[model samples]
Target: MKKIYIEIKWAFIYSITLLAWMLLENTLGWHQERIADQWWLTLLFIPFAVFIYLLAVREKRRRVYDRKMTWPQAFLSGAILSVFIALLTPISSYIINNYITPELFFNAMDYSTKNVGMTQSDANEYVLLTTYLWQSPIGALAFGLATAAIVALFVRKK
Candidate 1:
């Protein structure tokens, strides 16, 4: 419980930072909620990245790689961390979509459609794909591995 509390606190801190960044960078500055909408996409990385970062280090230093946790263990915990993002992302999305300024979504969608050199259908498809793709297991693996590797380099077991 102590270990988990430590790990999650860092991840949540980074996640909140990212969220604040999204609010400031996308909607407030450029008035680009569509791009900002995608910012929530990072919610996927926050928990997985931080936890795997710490866990991989601990696992390696303790010489427990031989007893490595199955991917299921890493992934299940990652999913739990992301749940925070999932809950907050949609509510944030709603506030941006409905309250802050409705035109931002339309503007972003329009900009994406025109600049991508794709038809409306394709652009819409891209948006949908990009939105959910970050949360997939593949994304988790990619981020988790990269983060874990870096943290592992510095890990020292107790």
Candidate 2:
């Protein structure tokens, strides 16, 4: 528990950053009038995600491992951080979908059915809050682990 203090702290930071990004997207009209551009614009979050992972692993290496961390140590620390992020993703998603951008699903469904050729049923199934409730945590884990792996390689000292 003591050793993972850094990971826990970084996990909160990552979750806050994710929420901030969603707020930015909503403010930019991506959740409504600019829904068409939302998909690509959202992908821009990759850099922020990677940077957060890098910072997490680097902090763990510097603080927990005393600057002598190996690849495995960094990777484990990041994996733990990823787990924390995964655990928090549902709450973040709930807040974002329910509060920050309540109309996002409807807008996405509209775009999907009109421009992307998705049937209404398909769009409904794909774009709802329940769907995001499940997808968000899975996506967070998958992306977080992948980011952790790559970031571990770079942050590892020896």
How high is the CA lDDT of each candidate model? 0.50, 0.90
Model number with the top TM-score: 2
Per-residue lDDT tens digits for candidate 2, residues 1-158, read: 88988888999999999999999999989889999998899999999989988988887777777888888898898899999999999999889988998888888999999999999999999887788899888988998888888998899886
Per residue, candidate 1 scores C-alpha lDDT tens digits across 58-150 of 543334333454444444444444444444455555554465545554666677777657778766765553464444434544555555444
- How displaced is residue 112 in candidate 1, in Å? 2.4
Worst 10 residues of 1 by lDDT: 56-65
Candidate number of the best lDDT: 2
Query: Lowest-lDDT window of 10 residues in candidate 2?
Result: 57-66
Candidate 2: list runs displaced more than 4 Å. Answer: none
Clashes of 1: 0
